[model samples]
Target: MTLDFSVVTDVWQSLVYGTLGTLFLAVAGMIIATIIGVLGVAILRTHMVIPSFLVTAFVEVIRNTPFLVQIYFIFFALPLAGVRLNPTMTAVLALGLNGGAYAIEIIRGGVESIPKGQTEAGLALGLHNHEVFRMIVLKPALRAIYPSLSSQFILLTLTTAICTSISAYELTSVGQRIEAETFRSFETYFTLTGIYLVISMVTMWTLAAIGRRAFNYPQR
Candidate 1:
């Protein structure tokens, strides 16, 4: 019944390695999701009815489904269709797609919040449609939604723990292995909980600093 943290000392390296794996998965997924989000927004904004419909459908399907199920499908089902992927890749793809669905809506809201006159003004200035989007709209929209986007990414980082379900070898998976070895379930999980909190706080603070640098401006 005595509490012992000596087990942690023994397994600290493994836990640290696992945390780095978790960070890698989260960061890779975030990059993929951001790319997908930008593309999804572009597709949705297009005048083409079919592409817009398809993008909307993709967003709806991903947003409505449970992330675990999506991961299972990516890990379990895709291989059956001859589209095999490694556990890490599967985890990244699943997490990215899941996050992308939410990001689309977030980015779309940012885009929509800008006054229509801004778009018109950009077009009137002899800019191409893409240039107008990039120069006149995208930056401001991103600045407006940067906080929400950062929060989503933080959630994405936490969601990396679920990657362990697919044996993706993230922090939670390593913690489970350590717990199995040490039989110190309480101490192991408590430490993991604390580590996750630290990760979350660090991520938030880092994003806030990036936001200040990227989005700071004089408000009228």
Candidate 2:
């Protein structure tokens, strides 16, 4: 079998566009996931039984269910409830909700690691609830969990490929179009593998830099 890379050369522009699309989805989804995670933790800390129980239930359901099914439900079933969204929106929403579940647990562990005295100290200093959360609990917890969150974000970035099932304009959807035209199955997928690796590497580097800036702590 003659492996031809000329197929990749011909579809290079499409691939580039797809990479940009994937990056957009990944970054946007990461932002949404982070917001959900932080907010979820805040609600759980309130110790209000009903709200805490609901948040716990949301996390548990998302964590237990398959991501593919979650995406499908958001894209298809949500419309029946009048929540119509384009594939891109649906994919971003699903990715955020899915990642947020894990983020909640990761961030919660970080929070739990901190001694309760710090929180009590902050309260005694006359800090408001949100202030204590933002200043005392959240920042350090995020620092502690940064590596895990970075890994999860990278996985979320790769998961963008799955958005192709809904015709989202991401890397995999673009690759499928190119593959259909080129019929170089092995070559096409081989090229895609390389591209995905590069994207993951770049994402990892970016996350590392952000962590260094945001979570820099003196090593004891």
Candidate 3:
């Protein structure tokens, strides 16, 4: 059988829409994950034992479980408890929680790497604890872990493909529909693979640029 590239032309619009949906999911997820990561780190750093323990448990549970199971729980199990979310919202929430769990550890490692003197110095300089954390600790720690964070985010974007499992209308789901309608599974999936690759590369470059601008510091 001869391979035909013409099939893609017929479904290009669907593919574009699918790609945009994927980007929306990933961007929304990352924003939520970043907030969770910051809060989780703060909770863990506090002297309050219960909150720390709760955050730790959350991190452990999310990081250890399969992402697919987590998403399934959010999308299917929640509605049974009187909480209903659309597919896109469910996907974003699941991805955020999963990525946030990992981010907690990443950010914690970065924070821990800082010297004790820095925190003390910030405190001595009339900065409140929260102020010190935000101005001194969080920014520097994020810089230290920016690469790891960015890579994690890229992984999160790739994981958006899993949203297709819940009929989230992402790239893979669109590809599947096109494949069924066009009877071109090979061509459809092959094109999808390339599209995903391009997304990943573009995401990485964009993150690198953000890092340079946000964390611009003179290297010693």
Candidate 4:
């Protein structure tokens, strides 16, 4: 049997919007994830019993759950509590919370890898503790975790496809509509897979560029 990508090709404009939507969800989610990751690590380091325990609990819960169930809960279950978020917002929130959990641990590992001497050196340099953390610790720690963080973010981007289940406007959702209308299941999903592969590559390239710019310190 021959393939017919023409079904997908007939609606290129919808595909563009779908791809844009995916990027929007991924970018917004990554922003939230980074914020949560950084904040979670900071709170955990403070070792305040209550805050630390809450952060730990969040990490454990999110890390252990299925992402599909999490998204469904945010979209379907929260409305019962008067927390009504549209599908788009719910999808972004789900993706962010999911990625943030992993980010917390990834960043913590990087922070722990820094030698204590570096902190001592920063302190001796007449810098405030906060300044030392920002200037000396944060950058190096980010450099150490850059690879892992980038990979996680890439996975997060791919996860946006699952948002289709919630009717969030993403690449896979668009493909589903096309498939339903065209009755081209094989062609629709095959092209969807190709599009997703492109997205993954683009995301990987963008992350690599960011890492280079942010951590391009001279190697000793």
Task: List per-prediction Cα lDDT, in the order shown.
Answer: 0.91, 0.92, 0.93, 0.92
TM-score of 4: 0.96
What TM-score would candidate 3 get against the native? 0.98
> On residues 73-153, what C-alpha lDDT tens digit does candidate 1 reach at each position?
998999899999999999999989989999999999999998999999999989999998876788899999999999999
Error at 174, model 4, angstroms: 0.5
Number of clashes found in candidate 2? 0
lDDT of 1 at 43: 80
**For model 2, how does the per-residue alpha-carbon lDDT over 46-73 read when each residue is reduced to its tens digit?**
9999999999999999999988999999
* Residue 114 in candidate 3, Cα distance off native in Å: 0.7
Clashes of each: 0, 0, 0, 0
The regions of model 2 sitting more than 4 angstroms off are 217-220
Q: What residue runs in model 3 are displaced by over 4 Å at the alpha carbon?
A: none
* Residue 67 lDDT, candidate 1, scale 0-100: 91
- Top candidate by lDDT: 3
lDDT of candidate 3 over 123-214, digit per residue (tens): 99999999988988888899999999999999999999999889997999999888888898889999999999999999999999999999
Per-prediction TM-score, please? 0.97, 0.97, 0.98, 0.96
